[model samples]
Target: MASDPVTLNEFLTERLGAGGVVDDPNDLLRYITDWAGDHRGKPLLVARPRTTEEVAEIVAHCHCHGIPMVAQGGHTGLVGGAQPDAERPELVISLERLSRIREIDPLNFTISVDAGCVLQSVKDAAMEHDCDFPLSLGAQGSCQIGGNVSTNAGGLNVLRHGMMRQLVLGLEVVLPDGRVWNAMHALHKDNRGYDIKQLFIGAEGTLGIVTGAVLKLTPRAQATRTALVAVPDVAAALALYGQARRSCCDLLSAFELIPRACLELAFEAAPDLPDPFDTVYPVYVLLEVAASGSVDLDAMIEHLFEHGTTAGMVLDGVLAGSDAQAERLWQIRERMVEGQQLRGEHLRTDIALPISSLGDFFHTASRAMAARSPETMVIAYGHIGDGNLHFNLLPPADLDLAAKKTLLHDLEAALFSLVDDYHGSISAEHGIGRVKQTSFLNGLDATERELFEGIKALFDPDELMAAGRILPRTR
Candidate 1:
């Protein structure tokens, strides 16, 4: 397979005709810039396929032409994983048009959908059948299931429902050589051979393009109890989390840590959002418990608070009295992201540590950053239940954006080193996209790097399936 620009264009026009080709530079703009505006690139062409067959055809043509392929979903990825790198002139295969909900099995509690289907759409379809697809995320409204599966996305509900890997029963992927592997078995037990579908789960599209998926659904929760509690510090937050997990057991759906800074920013951005506490505490926990049937959730939460307060774990608390109050409380969490986005230059790190080490991680990270640069603000917050913290570092308001770049490398190093020390993952939910590839590779040993290279060669020998991703070049 070799690339000849003129020859390939002619072949594309003859094969795909006018159906799914987008070569216009202006039209290709959306595919170039990443969702976070951190990375930008120019994709030689944008392929918008309407079906699995069309996607296969595109991949086959790209394979034969030695034209590297980049699979893009809703382009809502925070990392630059969806966007092509500046080094390569790759073809962007957007799965937006391949969006089609194939089937919904209420009895089996499974839903089959095309990879291009919006995550929220799939969740809505599951709800239509009286089931729940619990992979909830900030970008669910636009991000595709294919992207979610590719990155093995871990959303806010990872504490309860787990990641995309748990929800996904099977996947339909097109290999680098353009062969479709339809492993769409919706059965509970199938140890027939190698669990090959997993190879593409978190490969970051380095292995192949996921075209379709059969996802397992859960029984819909009929009742929920939501509470916003204040903790004196991270240690108290962890104590509250332990109590909630023990009391609620499997019913514990979410336990989120919200720093005072995050809440302050939210209040500044959205004044309509009601403050849960009269006096802002240093730390806050957004906790929720859900069950499939009606139960006295209020009493359970109230009872927990009664004892928790006595133990000095809960400094202050506010239970959502009504549905409107519940939604308003959730709004505070949702607005956290918006507030960060609107604020000055910041670096958002998605790292997960051992649940017990979360407080230490935050304390150490804040101290390290402040020692290195006191003007830097560390707005630490995330799912304490799952130990995934979006430990965001905000630059001084007076610091120039360009000047902040010079300080990023050192700050990121200190933070990642701290994470590694805690036996935590540098990337908890967000996959290691191009932006993190160098650091990701540097963290691996020769043995691990060798295995990564071997697998990359096996699935993508030509180095054409999103090469230089996860594994850097010069391997």
Candidate 2:
């Protein structure tokens, strides 16, 4: 007299009609994993809800049945946040059907969109009204707005526009117990107690499912200037960054640092990408300035170049004369990730420290990594202006599979230890999804760890939403 497994197909078909549930193994296979291809989890059924009411019904049904559920958006998360554990019979609630731009309030400088709306679509919708959605990334075409909100994603424009948290004005979420909290409103200042929208922004869907959002918009940039400047060293890079900050002020949209090794890899990976400088420098910076009003951006860039040249802060520079040229310059910066991948197995670390401590952090981490594994290839680059660095360590070319794993483990431990020494974060833009769950526990102390658990409990008492993600299980 064993109980039968829940007939998820029948359940979904009955509740949402045959169109809502997809039981085909081929279709389900794609939703079972994440962008990183690290986690492979299967679900009893993949449920696609078209409306908020449908989502509410599905969540409520799963809650009543004590069935574990995972909410998935574009599945572009780097930390395996959207992956489900195949060992368990889980239900994947796909937001693909919920894709829609509900409203655009240009007067309020906000756009209301369903959680399933792709990031690029939102940006396009904003542009339709002559407004701009400041939050953007390389995955703009694939990643969804709900996923961005869930991770509080930061991108190239963070120096000017801030993170996803800043752009989100309000949210509509479905609680675990089946109640819908419709807080979707475009309000600049609301003294409402608690500001519940903040709870779900970076919560990674652990608390509740984000159904929709009211996002802030900005005026489209009328003028933009991009430059690829070569610095003498890390110190000079920091100096030039300070000068740019002072001169350009708020117009300074991006200031990214790229190591020579990263550029080499980019050139290797992308055969068409041209080198900006005539000579290969130790470090190169991709800087951009955007203004809403009429301004001589080229003159401002020329002034910065002249100053840098005089001070020896910059050895050489190139300014993009056209939009195509600007995109070409940006391609070198954006392809850093793809370029690093060509090197083979590597342990990537996205850690952030104070801007003042970046040089020391890099020196110490590089030394520590070299001492541990002299042959390891280190590819380091990132948003130097905001102090976030991507310190990626590649396995030695001569090492075997087993040896490489050991090296990777040691490298991660040493790098994370150095990050801790600087009182920096282990994961910066990427949320603490499954990939960093262990790191999260290891990084936090007793008090901080307890507080994290308390917050999770406060939001999701049943621990049903995206379980085994940000928090570690108590043994």
The lDDT per prediction is 0.86, 0.86
Report the lDDT tens digits of candidate 1 across residue range 75-141.
9887788887787778888899888999998999999999999999998998888788999887889
Indicate the TM-score of model 2.
0.96
lDDT of 2 by residue, 330-375 (tens): 8887776877766666787788899999988888889998998888
Off by over 4 Å in 1: 1-19
- Candidate 2, RMSD to the unseen true structure: 1.8
What lDDT does candidate 2 reach at residue 3?
Answer: 13
Clashing pairs in 1: none
